[model samples]
Each structure stands twice: as C-alpha cells, then as structure tokens.
Target: MRVVHVASEVFPFSRSGGLGDVLGALPAQQARLGAQVTVVSPWYADITQAVREVWRGPLEVPGSVPLTDVRVGAFTEGGVQFLFVGLDAFDRPGLYFPDDVWRFTQFGRAVLPALEQVGVVPDVLHGHDWQAGLVVARARLAGLRAVFSVHNLQYQGRWNLMDGVGWTGLPDGVFTAEGLEFHGDVNLMKAGLVFASQVTTVSPTYAQEITTPEYGEGLDGLLIRLTHEGRLSGILNGLDQERWDPRTDADITPFGQLAGKAACGAALRAEFGLDDAPILATVSRLAEQKGMDLLIAALPELTRAWNVVVLGGGDPRLEAGLREWDAHPRVAFAQGMNEPLAHRIYAGADAFAMPSRFEPCGLSQMIAMRYGTLPVVRETGGLVDTVPHEVGFRFAGATPEALADACAAARLTFDDHAEWAARAQEAMSLDFSWDGPTREYLGLYARVLSGPLRPLVGLERA
Candidate 1:
C-alpha cells in the first residue's frame, strides 16, 4: 500500500508537540511494514537542521493557482520515508505566517501537483490535524481516497467564510454543520471529517470522547454521526523505540551505560542537580490541556517530599508559576524543548509525572517507561494504554489531589529500591513501538479499500 501524509509539522523538522513526534515516527514505522510513504510538510527557515534540498519545479495549487515547488530531502531515522516539499510560500520564518488559513489552504491545495512532480500518486492521502484538512476535501473532488487523523478536535482550523470558500472553490452546499461550517465560519477540521474516506483519532477513548459534547468542541454530533455511519476509528500512537530506548541512548551517558537501578540513580542525581532528593520530572507543554495548573497547585505539598524538575514551555501562566515558586535546592524548572536535556531528564529522573486532563495519546509517559522511569499518570487516553498496571501509579480523576497523591505514591515507591527496580524492569519491557500501530493502520487501510467509502472519494490536481 502507498500512503502519502500531508501535515503542517513532522518531527525533527517542525515540532511543537506530540503531533510532530507522531508524524515523524509513524510514517517511518509504516514504511518498514511494507507501505511506501511520503510526507509533505512546510519547509520552515529553521528546518535547515533536518532538510536538505532534493528536487525543485513549478507546481499549481488551488485548482489552477501556481506556486514554485522546491522538493527537499528528508532523513527518516527509523523505518519511514520522508520528503519535505519546500514552497516559496513557506520561505518565510513563521509556519502559520501572517495568514495561517491562506498559508495552509495553499499548502493543502498544492500537495497533489507536488506529489505528481515526485512521480507517485499514493493509494491513500492521509491528512493530520487541520493543517492538512483541506487536502482531503480537494482529494474528494479529484477522485482519490483520503484519510484524516484528528490529533486534537478542539484545534479545528476555523476561518472567515469568504476566505475559506474562495480558497477551496467547493460549492456553497459544502459549508454546513454537516460539512465545513461551524458557527457561521468555515471549519477546516469539519471538512476533513466530512470528506475523508476514514476519520481516526489517536485513541479509542478519545474517539469516543470526541463524539460527545464535552470533548467534541461542538463537533461531537457530527462525529457521532460519522461513527454511526461507520466512518470513524481510533489507533493509539506509538513511540520511536530506537531513539527512546534507555540502554543505547548516548544522552544519558554513564547512567544508560549501566542498566540495573544503582548506577542509574547515581547518574540521575548528577544530571538534574537533585543528587540528594528524589527527582520527579514532568516533560510537557505548559498548558491547560496537560493540567500544568494542577501540577503547580500540588507543588507546595509536593516540595515537602520530592525534588521536582519541569521541562516544558507554553502559557505565560506556567512560566510564572514555575518562576514565582520559592527557590529550593530540590526544585528546578527547565522551560522549553531540549532533546539531549529531555533524554537526560527521562533517564535521570526517579519518576515522571503526566497528570493530563485529557491526553489523546501521550508519548512522554511511554518514553519515560522505556527509560525505566516510573510514570505517575492520570488513567486517560494513551497514558492508560501505554503505562502498565504494575509498572506505575495511576489515578482516575484529573484533579490536584489525585495528582498529588499519585506523586506521593511515586515518591514512597521510589524509596523502595527493590519494588522500584521490579517496576522499572516491567516498564522497560512494555512495547509501545510503531510496529503494532502501523499494522493496525494497514488493516484500517485495507478495510477502507474494500468498503463502500473507497469509491465515494476523489482527488483532483491543481
């Protein structure tokens, strides 16, 4: 099977969060499983780190709009094949740029002609998030099969009706609650859901969540209808084990050099400046969705027992909360994404915290588990899927008390080296690799091909 992925971000090239990690990991994993995959993403100025120029040509977008097509070489670390489509529109520094809707709309419409120049028409064009949502809508009119993956439903790309309608050139009938319209505006995510042959969320629980009013962000009714019509499915995202594995990682240095607990504990102390206190780390975007506020609320009680290190960046509230805290030797907050630092944090920390309010499929917990760091997570989404029952601590509620108690339990558990070692072994043994998810995706693809949804979709070149 041939699969083409169109998204705004792919890991190592453009990554703000888990979506980029997923885009980077899954495509390579799918390739290893015998599916030829090519991903088209924006070539940001900072993308110089991961992209090398490959092929260049003139391509038409938006069903006759022409744009310069600069194809760039992409390195796939795991098993996936990656190709960065560099466009003059993306020559600017910002990905969303001054006009986000216009930029992505142009990106969505431009993918077909770009792929044609690459000399391959995939059996399925997979769109991730609202960034590539318009691709499926364009594909539908052009006679091609399209699949849409919703990383987060709340982040639907909504724009003015005039701008969106003018960009796609689809009929006015396409803009409705059942179509692209949401609250009198054009919703990019809604269009993908309505037009794609298959609509999938990252987890089954999340898939169920989005069909309800609470998690749907007003699109639950439509999602419920889609599921009722047998169009929606869920597959948990997987981690790239090659990079996440503790045993072989160069980032951890001396700690990863020795596997069993004692050496790791010593090395971890030096890495995080928590040589005396038990270190508890949480690496995530400092946002409401991740429940960073809850983590902050629990900190006063937490500081009494364990050393805490937070690695993340987002809302100013989080930065303020971290900065405003009473400076203690046991607590430190490293704000932002530093890959080596992240790997070291995962390796060195005694425990990892992920008290997410609603995690679609968190990679941090899985990465932590792989590094043999026990996870204290809310029993939701991928956190539940990845963290083993015996390996880590879990709470049902998404509250400060729940998170605090989980951390307390983790701290107490950490004191017991024997039990921690046992759990660490178990956590390390858990398989959150891409192989399982990739096979599941392939099965979904085959099912879609056999089903009635196949012929209904179309793809047109610009």
Candidate 2:
C-alpha cells in the first residue's frame, strides 16, 4: 500500500496535541506493516532542528500559493518518508494562524502533486483535522481514495465564503450549505466530511457522540448521515509505547525501582517546594476545556488533603487562576512545556488528574498509566473509552464537586497499599500500542479501496 498523510503537525518535529502523536505513530506503523508511507507536514520556524535536505521546489500549485518560489525540503527515517512544505505561510511557531485558509489551502493543493513529483502514487491520501480537510477534497477531484480524520470537531476552521470560493478553486455550488458552506461561512471540516471516501475519528464513543448536537459542534447531523452510509469509522489512538515506557525511559529512573515511588514523591515535592503528601499532578494545557477551572476551584478543597503539581501553560486567565494558588503550601505551578519534567511528573505523582470538559483521544492518561500513575478524568470523550474502571477514577460532571469526589476516591484508593499497587499494575499492563489501531486503519484502507463497504469489525476498545 502506498499511503500519504497530510497534516500540520507530527512528533519529534512538530506537535500541539494528540493529533500529532496519532498522525506520527499511525503512518510509521503502516510503513512497518509493509506499506510505503510518506508524511507531509509544514516546515514551521523551529524546523531547523530537523535533519533535512533541500528538495526541488517551484512545484506549481493551482488556485493557491505558487510552490515555485517556496523552497521544498524533506527528511527520511525508519522506512517512512517525511516531507516539509516551506513557505512564509507555514513558517511560524504555531501550527495555526488567522490566515490558515491561504496557508493550508495551498498546502492541500500541493500535497497530491508533491507525492507524484516524488515518484509515488498513493493508494490512500490521509488528512488530519480541518488543516487537511481541503486535501481530502482535492484527493476526490483527482479520483484518488482519501481518508479524513477529525481529531476535534469543535475547531471547524470557518472562513468567509468570498475567500473560500475565490481561492479554493473548487467547483461551483460546493460552497452551498449541503457542501462546505455553513451559515454563509466556509466550513473546511465539512469539505472533508462530505467528500472523503471515508471519515474516521479517534474513538468509537466519540464517533457516536459527534453525530448528536450535544457533542457535534453543529456538524452532528451531517456525521449521522455519513455514519448511516457506512462511510464513518472510529479507531482509538495508541501511544508510542517505546517513548512512554517506564522500564526503558531514562526519565523514569528512581521511580521504576522498588520503594522508588516514596523517594520519587519526596524529590518532586522538594523541587516544587510543596508539603509531603499524596501528590496529584496535572501536565495539561491550562485551559477551561481541560477542566482547569474545576481543578483550580477544587484546589482549595483538594490541597487540604493532597499536594498538587500543575504544569503546562496556555490562556493567560487560566494560568492566572492556577498561579493564584501558588502561594498555598500544598500547591505548586510550573508553567510551559517541560517534556523531561512531564515524564518525571508522570513517574512521581500518585495520581494524574485530567478533568477535561472534553477529550478526543488523550495521550496523557495513557502516558500516566504507563508510569503506574493512575488517571482521574471526567467521564467524557476518550476519557469515557480509555479509563478502565478497575484502574482509574472517573467523574461525570465538569464541576468542582464532581471532580473533588473523584479525587477523594483516588486518594482513598491510594491509602490502600496493596489495592492501589494492584490497580496501578493493571493500568500499566494495558496495551495502548500502535498494533491494534494500525490494523484497523489498514482494514479501513483495504475496505475503502476495494468492493462493497461494510462496518469495520473487531475494533479494539481502549
């Protein structure tokens, strides 16, 4: 199988969330399974760290930015090929920007030809999120098979119709409501949902949730149609087990030994200047959606019993809310993306808390589990799918009270030495490996490319 993934992010190079992790792992695994895999992502500013060689550019891209002046580059590794589209529109710190329509629209137009230029005709063109929605549409125009994955439905990438129809070079009537148009604005997500040969999301429950207005972000009705037509699928994401493993990860050091957790907790407490107590750590984006507000609100109540470590920075106001608790003896806040610290936090903490108001497919919960730190998440999205009842705690509401109840349950569990250790062992034993999801993806690919369509069977539950 010749497969190409078009996305704005990938790991070890670029990432914002689980989208990058999923895109990176899925393709690499596909390559290992004997598929010829190529991943094309934007060469953002920090791409200087990547080992790449300048490739021939000036590749003509119709209806968008000319690749002629844009210098193309590429790097290959481990049986998979990586390509980067270097242009001012993509050369930025963040994966997204205000003018993303122009940026990725041109990128979508360039991807198919880029593959052809490299002497490969893909059997499947895979697109991730709204960033690659246009790529899926372009694949259909070229009469090729394409799969569009919706990592998050909330971010639809809506823009004006004038810019959409004018620059997209799409056929007439495509901008209508039945197509990519939604309430007079161009919805990039809809473009993929409507045109792709198959549509997939992260987990089965989330796929079901999205077809309802409650979780749909206004695109539920359309998704329901697609699901009924047997063109929609949900494959739960898997983690890079090698990177997150406790036995091999250097960062997991002292924590992996017998009685190491006690020393680990003490060291982390000293580093954060917090009181010695049962530690709850959150290495999550400081945002309302991650249930940061509930965590903050419940902190006064939670800190009274547990020492808490908060990491990751985002949304000034949310960070401020967490910072206000910094003076508390049991509360510590370390802002920003500290990868080493994150690994340590997972290893050191007694419980990893993620009271997300919504989650597509959370890698942190799985990452925390890999380190033998139990997860406490609100019962929603991927959280509903992954948090095994025997291993982690789950709460229903996005309220402080509900979250506090869950944390209390976790702390109680922690008090039981044998029980807690047993649960942690069970959590650690989970197979969140790329094996299952990759097989499902290949099955989906084969099904989409071949004869009569049917629902994918034997999907592994996270």
Candidate 3:
C-alpha cells in the first residue's frame, strides 16, 4: 500500500515534541512492514542546512496571495520518501511560529500537488494534528482515503473565520457549526474531525477520554457522534526500540554485563553530588500539564527520602519554581533539552517520574521502562494503558499527595532490591515497539479503502 504522512515535524530532522518523534518512527516502521510510505513536512531553516536536496520546484498553492516562490523538495531515507515544502514563511528558525495558521494552511494546500509533482499517489493520506488537518479534506477531494490522528486535543488550530477561509481558499460554508466552526472561529482540528475517513488518537484510554466532557476540550459532542459512526479509534504509540535499547545503547553501559547498571547509577549520583538515596529522575518539559507543579510541591517530602534529578525546560514560572530546589541537598535541576543527559538519566535512575495531569501517550515513561527504570505516573491517558501495576507505580488524583504516595510506594520497592529488580526486569521485557502499532495503522488504512466513500461534509451541498 502507498501511504503519505503529513505533519509539521519529524525527529532527527526537525522536532519540537512527541509529534516529531511519532512521524519520524512510524513512517519508517510502516516501510519496513512492506508498505511504500512518504512523509511531507515543512523545510525549516535547520533542516535545509542538514539534508542534500534531491528535488526542488515551484509549488502551486491556492489563495489570494501569489505564492510564486513556494517550492517542494524531496529526499529518501530508511525506505521512506520525505518531501519538504518550502516557503519564505517556513524558512524561520522554529518549526512553529505565531503565523502558523497561515503557514500550515499553505503547507496543507501544497501536499497533493507536491505528491503529483513527485509522481506518487497514495492509497491513504495520513495527517497529524491541527497543522496537517486541512490536508484531509484536500485528500478526500482527490478521491483518496484520509486518516487524521489527534496527538493532543488541547491545541486546535483556531483563527478568525474570514482568515481561515481566505488562507485555505475553502468555501465560507465550510466554516459552519457542522464543519470547522468552534465558537465562531475556524478550527483546523475540527476540519479534520469533520472530513476524514477515520480519526485516531494516541491511546485507547485517551480515545475514550476525549469523547467525554472532562477531557474533550469542548468537542465532546462531535467526538461522541464520530465514535458512534465507527469512524474514530485509538492506537497506542510505540517506541523506537533500537534507539532506546539498554542492551546496546552507546551512551550507557550495556545491560548484558553484570554491574553495568549499578556502575552507571553510581556515576550519575556522583555527577549530581547526590547521596546514595534512591534516585528519581524526570526528563520532561516543565509545564502544569506535565504535572511539574505537583512534583515541585511534593519535593520537600520527597527530598527527605530520595534524590531527584530534573532535565528539561519550559514555562518560565515552572522553571523558576524548580530552580528553587537546586539548592536542596537531594535535588538536581538542569534546565533545557540535553539528549545525552536524558539517555544517562534513563539508564542510571532507579525510577522515572511522569506525574502528568493528562498524558495522551508519553514516550519518556516507555523509554524509562526500556532501560529497566520503573515509571511512577498518575493514572490517566496512555499512562494507564502502558504502566500496569506489575511493571511500575500508579496513582489517582492530580495532587502532590497522590504523587508522593506513588513515589513512597516506589521507594518501598526500591528498598527491597530483589523486588525492584524483578519489577524492572518485567518492565524491560515488555514490548513497546512500533511493529504492533504499524500493523494496526495498515489495518486501518485497508478498512478505510474497502469501505464505501462517505459524502464529503461541509465542502459539498447536501
């Protein structure tokens, strides 16, 4: 089957978060599964400098503004073709900018033409997040099956109705209540939800959670209808096992050798000047959604018994809050993204803490578990699906006390070396690889292709 994945980011080339990681790993895995895959992403400044361009030409983009300079380029990697759409707007430093609504709309408009230019037609056009949302409708117009994946419900691409219509060159009628409209604004996420042949989220629990009022982010009614129509489902995200494997990772001691983990742990403790207490590490963005605030609040009680190491930076207020703990004897806070340190933390820490208020599907916990580090997470989203009690610690309620209780339970297990080792071994043994999720995606695509084509909503007259 021929498949095309449209997203704003892809790992190792350009990425801001999990969306990049997903696109990076999933398409490659799909190619390995005997499917021809193509990934379409913006050619940002950082990526332009790294890759040798294979193809480049002017792109046909719809809108009032004459986009004569818009171009598309291509490169091949890991058996998958990558097409990068370029515009002066995309030449900016970051993957996402303030004018993203206009930028991605243009990117989405270029996808089909770019594919045509490259002489590839896909059986399914898979779009990720709000950035690629507009592509789904365009794919349907081209008589192709389209699948839309919602990585997070909170970040719907919303803008003025007139602006969205103008940018997309879509009819004003498509901006109504049953279409892209959300509170009188044009929501690109809603466009995907309304137009796609199938809609999926990261995890099973999250799929269910998003259909409810609590986690729906004000789109529960629509999600509920989609669920009933049998057009919506969830497939859990998987780790790139080769990249995260403890047995062969070059960054840390290979697990095959005896005392490798222990030696690494000792070195980590020394690096942080931490005493020989159970080390709890977190490699995450410092944001309230990640439950960093709760971690901060629980620090006083937690530091009394365990040493904590934090690696990540976001939300200046949260950064300030965590920095205060830097002076504490048992706390080590390193702000900003450090890939090498993250790998070391995963290998050396006794347990990983991801007390997210709501996590769709977290890669960090999976990565931690791959290194035989038990995850202590709150019971929500994919955290509930991946981290069973046998493998790690879990707690309910998004409170400091709840996180502390889970950590306390983990501390108890840590004190019992044999028990901790057994649990860690179980976690390490569990499969979180991309093979299964890739198969599920292929199945979804087949189902979409076999099913009767539903009438396009919003874009057509009833």
Best by TM-score: 3
Tens-digit per-residue lDDT, 1-462, candidate 2: 888898889987888777887877888898899999988888888776655655556666556345665555688887888888776677567777778877877777777776677676888888899989988877776678888999999888788888777667777557676677898888888888877889999988788889888889999888998988888878899999877877777764644543566666667877888776889999998888889988999997798779999998988998898788898888889989888898889888989999988888788999988788899999888888888999999999889999899999998888999999899888878899999999999998898889542222221110
**How far off is residue 1 in model 2, in Å?**
0.4
Clashing pairs in 3: none
Runs in model 3 lying further than 4 Å from the true structure:
48-58, 257-259, 457-459
Better of 1 and 3 by lDDT: 3
Model 2, position 161, has a per-residue lDDT of 85
In angstroms, give how far residue 128 of model 2 lies from its true place. Answer: 0.5
Q: Between candidates 1 and 2, name the one with more favorable lDDT.
A: 2
Poorly placed runs, candidate 2 (over 4 Å): 50-54, 64-67, 254-258, 452-462
Query: In order, what lDDT does every prediction score?
Result: 0.80, 0.82, 0.88
Tens digit of per-residue lDDT, candidate 3, span 1-462: 999999999987898788999998999999999999999888888885345455466665666555666566677889988888887788767777778888888887877877787688988999999998889877776677899999999999899887777788666667779888889788989888988999999999999999999999999999999999998999999998988888888887778533468877987898899998989999998899999999999998898789999999989999998898899989999999888888899999989999998999999999998888899999999999999899899999899999999899999888898888889888888899999999999999999999988786545741
lDDT of 1: 0.80
Local error of candidate 2 at residue 166 (angstroms)? 1.5
lDDT of 1 at 419: 89
TM-score of each: 0.91, 0.94, 0.97
Q: Is candidate 2 or candidate 3 better by TM-score?
A: 3
Clashes of each: 9, 1, 0
